[model samples]
Target: MSDIRDEMLRTLDRIVEANLTIAEREKADGNGPSAKLWAALTEQGMTALGETDSEIPFADAMALVARSGYHAVPVPLAETIMARRLLSRADIALPEGSITLAARAGGQANLVGVAYGGTAAHVVVADGDSLHLLQVTNAVVHNAYNQAGEPRDTIDLGKAKTIDRKPLAHATDVLIAEGALLRSVQLAGALSRTLEHCLTWVNDRVQFGKPIARFQAIQHAMAIMASEAAAARAAADMAVEASEKQADWFAVAVAKSRAGEAAGKTAAAAHAAFGAMGFTREHPLHYSTRRLWAWRDDFGSEVIWQSKIGQHMAAKGGENLWATLTEMN
Candidate 1:
């Protein structure tokens, strides 16, 4: 697989992350990824991270996705990966350039949401039973942005001219689950990065000629944040393993729930450590914290996925619930 820098936090340190995610880049005019960076990524085959029915394993693809989140790399990478995988599964032609996936509900008239909405050249729309491939030029796009300065475009499919459409049963639901899984992993990533920033801040910020990390309360908060971040990362890895069979919602629900819950905790803990500095417009910490705040609510929020898990378990009854819990293993 063509890899992202080093698959480590320092990977983006090589690239100016602040430049990549500048708010100016997330504009209504349509903010595509930096052409130079895109070219480099494409040349390295990073754009093909999960293509070919994802001949690339989920673990590998998700690791890159997580890394992208860590740096708040503002591109439609995860969506592109899922979009390509969806197209390949239906034997459809894959379009060149960035491709994003958007799910249309049973009767929804327009493509409601997807990161990189107007920035992508193509889209794969899944509506429970089928997949429709579309060229962006064939549709009207209203550019918008998420809290993290990522593109969140709304596609006017009512006026779109489709390139191809094919029936792919349950694809819409699968995409939703997989999207949730992707976001969950991203949340975990940002949380980890946030904790790192917090740790550095507490260990370096001095008061009374002593680092704040020497204080008991700072140490306690750091421990809690570290644990939450670790749990979220563990959950992300577990979901990837479970979904090796398919885009299973059962696995995704657990991952999303844990990561979503951790997102808020980790962000709060991180900001608390940095105090006012973390919220400053120029601070790189906001990149990860803001993303953590937004991504937890994407795909499906903690409440939504947790409710789904509860409903499923309720229907399954006590004995079957235990079986289902261990089903992935």
Candidate 2:
């Protein structure tokens, strides 16, 4: 199993991620992830990596997503994986091409900020009590990009009939929690990569007859960045494990909140350590940091998930808080 995991990671790093050049990312920002890349991913069985029928274990699937974050794949790979998993559990046939989830319904069943919304062949959206699977060919698509230059568009399902529908077992809030879990894991991977870049830059950059990494100030910043990245990775690991066991939404909320906080702190520290170069497009640091900023706000932001955790704890009262947290451990 470890061998398989290592091989999988290598394939992603060498094949899927290595080919995602700056030019490819620029093209992806204008058009969606290239069809060739998608085809390559499909051939690797990555599109359905987490589905019920997949031979890959859930933990391995989640690992793939985290690696994607590290590489800043700039594709809807994570979205498509989750979409396939959701549809499979609901006993729906997986659609061809890319699939992505719509945001939790906002009053009128319109899903906005959908990853790959502009190009996805199908979208799974929350509609009343049902999860509506809509074919995107006829829907209204407003093409847009997130702060990270990833495709995040609005799709209005305007009178479209559901190709297949299933009763939503969980509330919209639960859906957000699930999305948060995914984003948290992805953020963890991005944060880890950002820290790596910062460390590399500081070690190689010399000033005042010594490497910047030798300075106390830079050392302190690097320590903070590494700690935050570690925390994010731990939180994401907790979320993935809990998800595999079918734990409640509270566990997911905790993971999302902690990871989001870590992402913000780590991004700031990394940028500070890298100095002006980190901010430029020529450097790849922006790729991870920008995605961290965008992803931390996606699903539910840190504040939102923190509120959910606080509210639940408050209702449980101060006395039970220790027990509740310990139980998770």
Candidate 3:
């Protein structure tokens, strides 16, 4: 398992180094992840790393992506992984370059938008319970702004022309639940990067004739950043484990709730500790922090996940919730 994890990390490093160059160029061009980077990643099988039928350990995959996030490499890691899972379940060949997968209608329906959806080669809409597959072409897409300033668009199935239909056997909730977990993993990566940037900033920036990191106030801030990062990692790891083990939805709820809150707080602390420099376009800090802000709201926000978990606990007689979490691990 360790060897596999090392291999995954090496692969991730190669992808990041190569894509970092592209990301820099894209920033110059006022664009995001380039087509070439996406093509290269797909060619390298990154987009297909964790298929629905994957045997690779979930922890290893999550760790690999966490490292990727540490470098702020611009790739659609979460969306691509979800796309692979959906395609694998449908036995459909995965598309190349900039694909987005959505699970909605209470997970009964799954949708894929290609080339960022509007420009994708094909879009697959599936009704998991009914085993229905619908192919839509030239998907109608809508621009949606996120905190990261990256390109995000929505696919309108009503405007899509159905090409084929098939029956699927899995529960829709399964896909939705998996997506939520996958999102948590992505947030783990962003959160880790934000912490790294914050620490690096504190160590280098001098204050009152010494490194700011030496100041007690700055030390306290750094401690909080570290604590939040640890919590976020734990929550994300639990979410990934639950998804891999097919655990109860309650586990997913807890993990997402904890991770979402931790990520937002961590990113906020990181930016605050760095002062004005962190917000500048010249620094990479904003990239990770902005993405953290966006992703914390993805899958399910802190409010939604907390409410769900609280409701579950209340229904379970509100007894020994802490014990339940400990036992889940």
Q: How well does each candidate superpose onto the true structure, as a TM-score?
A: 0.90, 0.95, 0.85
Q: How do the residues 117-232 of candidate 3 rate in per-residue lDDT, one tens digit apiece? A: 54444444545553223344444555444667654556666666654444455545655566667667677777877877877888999888999999998899888877877887
Q: Which stretches of candidate 1 lie over 4 Å from their true place?
A: 1-32, 52-55
lDDT tens per residue, model 1, 199-314: 88998999888999999999999999989989999888899878764677888899999999999988888888888888887777987888888899887899999999999888
RMSD to true structure for each model, in Å: 2.9, 1.7, 3.4
- When summed lDDT is taken over every stretch of 10 residues in candidate 1, the lowest stretch is 21-30
lDDT of 2 by residue, 114-229 (tens): 88887788887755556667887656557777888888777667744579988766635545666787888899899989988988899999999999999999999989888888
Task: Rate residue 164 of model 3 by lDDT.
Answer: 42
Better of 1 and 3 by TM-score: 1
Candidate whose TM-score is highest: 2
Model 2 — which ten-residue stretch has the worst lDDT?
A: 168-177
RMSD of 2: 1.7
lDDT of each: 0.78, 0.79, 0.65
Q: Which 10 consecutive positions of candidate 3 have the poorest summed lDDT?
A: 107-116
